[model samples]
Target: MKNRNVILTGAGTVIPWGAPSTDKLTDILRQDSIFINDKGEPIGEYLYSLLKTQMGKRRAYNTPNFESILHFIELLFEYKKSRYSMSSSFFRINDFFLIDPEIQNKLEIYESQKLDKRLDTSFGTKRLIANEYYYYELYLHFTFLIKKEIEKYETVEEKYHELNKSFNRFLHQVKGENGIVRFYTLNYDYLVPKISNLKFFDGYDEKTGKMNVKKIIEDDYIDCYYHLHGSFKLNFIGEKSNDYSVCYVQKNFVQNNLIPSNIITGYNKPERILNETFYEFYQKMIEDLIKANKIYIIGYSFNDMHVNAALKRALKKGSAKITVVDKCSLEDFHLKYDKIIDSNPDYDMNKLIKFPNTYQMTTEALKAKAYLNGLNDFLDNLIRSNN
Candidate 1:
């Protein structure tokens, strides 16, 4: 009965479910759109005001590069942090965030060449540290904004109803439900569990109210969920939980100590994944990938190096086939996967691969009658095969 192997979905699969895509989120960030809080204050204006004030107070505004750096940091942090909320920073103490190669490279180059004075000065250091906290605060604001947006979708009911409808239609088409079709996501949106009734596990033992990755693996679970990046509800060590202070999943979020945001973002994503909790989640994903006979990627973009590496390793270790369902062209998709495949040349390049023949379809277009029928048929045939 375990005919079709695994179904891997990215943020794109949820587009029909009311989540923003990568391009849409980027478009939103480029604008000066005003989002209001429950208190009716314009949050975007407030964020800009805070950024300007913080930089000015630290005398970073005097530096020609300050405004540009601030803008870059805001955009960078917002892009990564907003992903989980729509679907979906900080200074670290400056040194913390700067450890990321991309952010660090940008800052060092800006400082060395563009700064009016040597960045080694006490004032420069204060400025860097100040921006760190400013970015962190901005991240908090974004979290609040996402929570507000999710509230607009009839909280959990309507959203989950929609998910169940679409996904059940999908499940009805598959050959068999024998093998567990695990959903491993980089998204932080907390809506997937409500949509499916299958045994949902995300490395945290809800029974104990702690993140025990081993207990998750040891359990006799046929179906398991892995949040490769992290989730909004669970708070990690360094993350700042929005005042909600309660995970949406807990029976009593107020009474129980919720897991913090155990996610990886910004430039430190790969580095943070090395931490114990994330490392466990990632290792387990690779394990599952190897066991799967077929892999179906729905909305994923295949951008993360860590994920790509795991997928490649899984392909090398097993004969699992791949199917990508996204708007990207076959060429583009192949190129992206090739980035993973080319990294390890010894692995066989040929395996059953399929994608949407129609290009440039919106998430809506992709879900249209023609495409959906084609997709369902393709998957059915793939799963029905006894080969």
Candidate 2:
């Protein structure tokens, strides 16, 4: 019997490849940003306040989330241009935008503390933002920072291979298998290709290098390799991409820009995941999850609700065996995910709590084998256990 296998890797997998952890990335973004408006006004005070913890609180007091902050910034870039509805005069966008609302009221009512401070203090910032020029600059900086970090995947040290012994063994097993194998990732880097020497189609046309998503989705026997999140290489270049373009463009050639770095980050992922080629990959993931006999998860946090929903749907069926490889102990991993799933009452994903397929990576297994700390830790435990 062929053992059909599905694998899902996350940003944690790219940590070995020199990608910054979320907290570190947050720090880098905070430390480096100029926080000055396009019109020469200093907005650093309020901008940093939004990032800081309760004005005087320590790092433990809810360290500001990089994803949430970036998402809020994206929202600010969009809703700053609020206007009276031309269609319906009674319904003003300002009603939704809170035109100069009190800071305390905003703090009490809105999750985005940065929004009102941004609107209240910085008139120049608000004006420049309303005109759409400042938004582009902010977007460019954030995207560029992310791009720089992921690009370091090429420069990662060879020593990290010590942490990858289990995966290497898994890959060797895969090499000998006649079973259907699928690989998917939530990372925005090309590390997948670097690790897996297998040739796989990723919806992009081989000759034109442009993606034909519809055609690829229609094909039945295409290699089930996909990037669940978009990648740095997958830019959509066109005049249409100008409105929210975060493309790498010359100062002179801004008009001829790619519409946003295709690498999906921050928030609003369910909607963003449907963009262009990712839609096909998303569909493929669902299909693979449903049909898979065994699933191997590497370095994923099950944090994405959209993805978790799909995974929960699959888990509810109680079929696929699961093996997770991460730096964390299985108990800690369960708690981390339990906190996420328990909080979300809308989706009952508690099925994952006792899924009965956590194959030999648990703390008990560690005790039986040896100390397995992280990806950079010794491979002795994993190698001996597998043998």
Candidate 3:
């Protein structure tokens, strides 16, 4: 009778050796490093060079910082797919034409046509090409950098296979009427679905080649993967341009002949969560969590204000038991939640019945608590018996 919903955050929470995946992203971030030169002064030469090469005759936007540039790119993609339509064919086409290189060249030509006169002229064309080249080059560099760093650890592929084995073992041993494993992740990475062997709820019928609202139940196993922060790979209509959307480089672009780089960074915006398509996805995930008997939080800092609010809302609707798997001590964890709880005056900390059901421990400790002998065995036995 134990229904567990596992939520895992990325970054600092899932560190293997005191380093998060973001560490590998530094090279890409610093590729166009904007800092002072060796003379203890701003590197005007580099900035000017980039401006000349990338901006051309186009009037610069009010915000010229790298953050703005990145945000602009992200927004451009967001504006394109305003409809939030979902079609496998569209997905495949975008992946091939917009994501992969073979088709990206064609997309670039198409995109060029839509540019304003300022951006469509010879100078603009040259700047666009240069900017595109720079962007893609940086992307490839980052990909390789991450790949190299990943190689240092056990291969994600290998880890995924191992995790699968563990999951299968857990499922086989834990018998119940509800054979559902609810998974929530803060990672922008797509490792969970790849490992879990789960597919999006597209409601596609292979035999008829038609879309249907009826759910497809594959086998007796059902694993639900929920993305807490928007997925890095999920394609969204861009905010800047109306012609294109953001997509995954590998799945949507590389395999399909579309571009192989993400156009946006800094995806933790409140507005993004409320996007029509994303809102539905979030609602479905919340519903699943609410129906669960127990909640497992892993690899999350619980610092994201929006996510924390959402979790609190969900908790308010349900009376499920909660367990936090983190590196911090119980007192520290309580203090962290205390801030969240204190923010809402309606919820009194002393009378908060939900807090008693919460538990915290490190991943290693949690694993030990569930498997090891002596104290671990006693704890696991007690928990299982109580449940």
* TM-score per candidate: 0.58, 0.69, 0.48
Error of 2 at 353 (Å): 15
Candidate 2 vs candidate 3, lDDT winner: 2
Candidate 2 stretches with Cα past 4 Å from truth are 33-48, 51-62, 84-131, 156-166, 218-223, 237-259, 329-331, 339-372, 376-380
Model 1 C-alpha lDDT per residue in residues 89-158, reported as the tens digit of each score: 3333221222245534433332232211332221112121223333434444344344344334424556
lDDT tens digits, residue span 1-387, model 3: 445444434454335422344533443333423223333332222333333334444554321333323333333243333354323234332112223344334333433432223321121121222233333323333333443443343235454454455443433333245546666565544454444334533222445533222342232134555454543332233111222233323222122222233222232244445532344445555665566655555555565666676667656754555544455455555555554343333333222121222332223221111111222222344455547
How big is the positional error of residue 49 in model 2, measured in Å on the Cα after superposition?
Answer: 2.8
| Candidate whose lDDT is highest | 2
Cα lDDT computed for each candidate against the true fold: 0.48, 0.54, 0.39
User: Which scores better on TM-score, 1 or 3?
Assistant: 1
Of candidate 2, the 10-residue stretch with the lowest lDDT total is 250-259
Backbone Cα, N, C clashes tallied per candidate = 14, 1, 28
Supply the TM-score for candidate 3: 0.48
lDDT measured at residue 13 in model 2 versus the true structure, 0 to 100: 65
Please write out the lDDT profile of model 2 over residues 222-291, one tens digit for every residue.
Answer: 4456777777665433112213323332211222222244666665676566544566788888877877
